[model samples]
Target: MPQLKGIKILLVDDEPNILRFLEIGLQNEGFEVLTAQDGLSAITLVKQFQPHIVILDVMMPGMDGFEICRMLKKTENLAVIMLTAKEEVEDRVKGLNLGADDYMVKPFSFDELLARIHARIRNHFPNMWGEVVAGPFRIDDRRKEISYEDKVLELSPTEYELLKFMAINNGLVLSKAMILDKVWGYDFNGEENIVEVYIRSLREKLNDREHRLIRTLRGSGYRIDVQ
Candidate 1:
């Protein structure tokens, strides 16, 4: 339902019917859509179009969706959604671990796919302006940067989202479900352990010998309290 006008989306699928279907659906929503039938063409369109979002099919003939997702993630602020025919948990997790923003299995509803695309764009580029501070940590929503004291942390897209959510809530104790919903969006059908994976990744990047930024509560979830 978000205003998608001028938002470019690249659809990469070998099936011409699928590509046409999605292109029409997205175009109807006021998005500028580009189509690619293979990984090589996807990469070329990516460089040329520099789309804000990409809907990629997993099982292409050469250069699978996973490889393309990994490559495209190197771009600073691009969002990716992987589409797979298989409903395996391993496939979903692998895609997410490889930095895909979200994934959908085949036969997914057009409405749901549109919602996911909107959610990804919304989460990545929040409307908030200026910086938020919690003790020694500062999160600049406009800049998409997080700093501890005077040093900035090099965090991935997922890591930055998780950390920013916690930082916004500050000392509040956030349940795993709440964090998952806020950070990963309601479309994420993966296990709660995905939250743990991102938390561990954030902890590693926020490693400070004297101060702990994220605190875990037994039987509860996590809280960010900078001292």
Candidate 2:
């Protein structure tokens, strides 16, 4: 819905049928789709295609999606959505921690997947163009980067989105549900603990022990208070 045309998307899966199905489906949606059957090939295609978003499948024969997500994170501005057959929370958390922007279990609805893809694209490429400053923290929307005190913080895709969203609404108590709807999108069907997991990760990156940028509100939620 958000001008998906000409946006490059890479699909990585071991199943030939799955690859073909997703390719056709995405192509029909006006996305420029590419396919890879393994992690190694996926990496190669990513380099060549320079896709804006990658739909990666876990449990490949060789490199695996986790490793691929890590590799891709090194590239600036590439959004990754992982596909996994395992429904375990650990797997989902692992992917998010490894820098995946989102993940969908196997046998997932194509429509839901498309919605996630759109949401991720919109989050990563917001219309606003400028730097958001709150105390020592800064979010450069144009560059898609965040900095703390003058030093740039190395953040995963999900962490970056969460931080940016909070920074935009600095000092406001944002509930977990509000965060899920804003950062993860309204259609997210994953566990709410996912928010806790990412918050822990963000706090670590922000060095909150000393700076105390993100504060937890016991009964409410969390807020970014740059004091």
Candidate 3:
């Protein structure tokens, strides 16, 4: 397995024993971990820590996980996994509808939770993973290589960065200025049309001649939708 050393995780649960257990276990697994016993603390820590993933408990005394999850989704790009004692399908559906990336019932297997954590972060926080998976695109940071639909792409350093940026932010529409600042440097003084050039190159390589995978939003910049 790849190392998840630098990833930040926030665990929110009112139970002291559960929080202590998870905090210890996750730290041992190399994740930078934090624990919040209530929704208010969790929200505060989220702003301060900006963790890549949040494991939230559903039944706190006030501002339950569903409400916290709702608020978390509105302003954050992080992944949320709901932990609840309830086993009802409706509860799970409600959590999912509220934008939780995953749900786990209490007394769950720790190994399974860890696996789900890996999966959720890999899919949502691609840049933090050694090997990133976004839809059909796979990026191996160690090898500095990427493949689309299992076919390897021959890309320049610039193109690789551009594609990686867009893939990680899969469904979000990005403006030209945003892409330029990210792929190029924040201080890049180059023309924005350079983005157009690289996009064309990448499209040709992906066989996206009709621009289905990466769509141009006309006035807006671009968005990648491999799904």
Candidate 4:
């Protein structure tokens, strides 16, 4: 099962290998990730993307991580975790003073970094932590599973993404265009009827033949009415 939370994270590092490695790891763990090799681009992406957390590397050309973190914390309501090769106490203190929520040295375990990211999310954005429960459905992002009425649903990758998106926006009327852009990438050149096909599949699996839980709004689109 793929992790389903749409948590956005920004990874800033000047090293291509480091960026590629972390990007693949985090994406596998179900995070929406964006990367920047320089501080200026990092700042720009932060304003544009508004990620929930930032993984910052301290040593870089132009503007360093410390200065970037300082600028970010002043205007952004997000967590910052600093990474550095140096193990000096002064550097750690400086990062913390500049509003970094956590610190990790280079060569750190990926598991440890994942744990710290969860910790920071829990500490800083407590409301967004853990499973998403709405009506009879429970979406466990960490486990990448969704259960209906305490029974886990066997869902394909696309089904999982589509259902999770609907569950997140449960009472809102979601048009086909919006669903396609989100579930399938905006760059997906497929036909719009693809949304209808997936919706039918989800309805069948969900036993929503009567359209009580998943409703079709004539010309508008679809909605998940759990009540």
Q: In model 3, what is the error at residue 11, expressed in angstroms? A: 0.5
Better of 1 and 3 by TM-score: 3
Give the TM-score comparing model 4 with the true structure, all chains together. 0.60
- Please give, for residues 139-173, the per-residue lDDT of candidate 1 as tens digits: 77677888878689998888888887787566668
Clashing pairs in 1: none
Q: Kindly give the stretch of ten consecutive residues in candidate 4 with the minimal lDDT sum.
A: 1-10
TM-score of each: 0.56, 0.56, 0.59, 0.60
Instruction: Please give, for residues 51-73, the per-residue lDDT of candidate 4 as tens digits.
Output: 99999999999999999999999
lDDT of 4: 0.89
lDDT by residue (169-218, candidate 2, tens digit) is 66778999999999999999999999999999888877786546788889
Model 3 off-target regions past 4 Å? 131-227
- Give the candidate order by descending lDDT: 3, 4, 2, 1
- Model 2: CA > 4 A from native: 1-3, 127-227
Of candidates 3 and 2, the better by lDDT: 3
Best by lDDT: 3
- Superior by lDDT: candidate 2 or candidate 4: 4
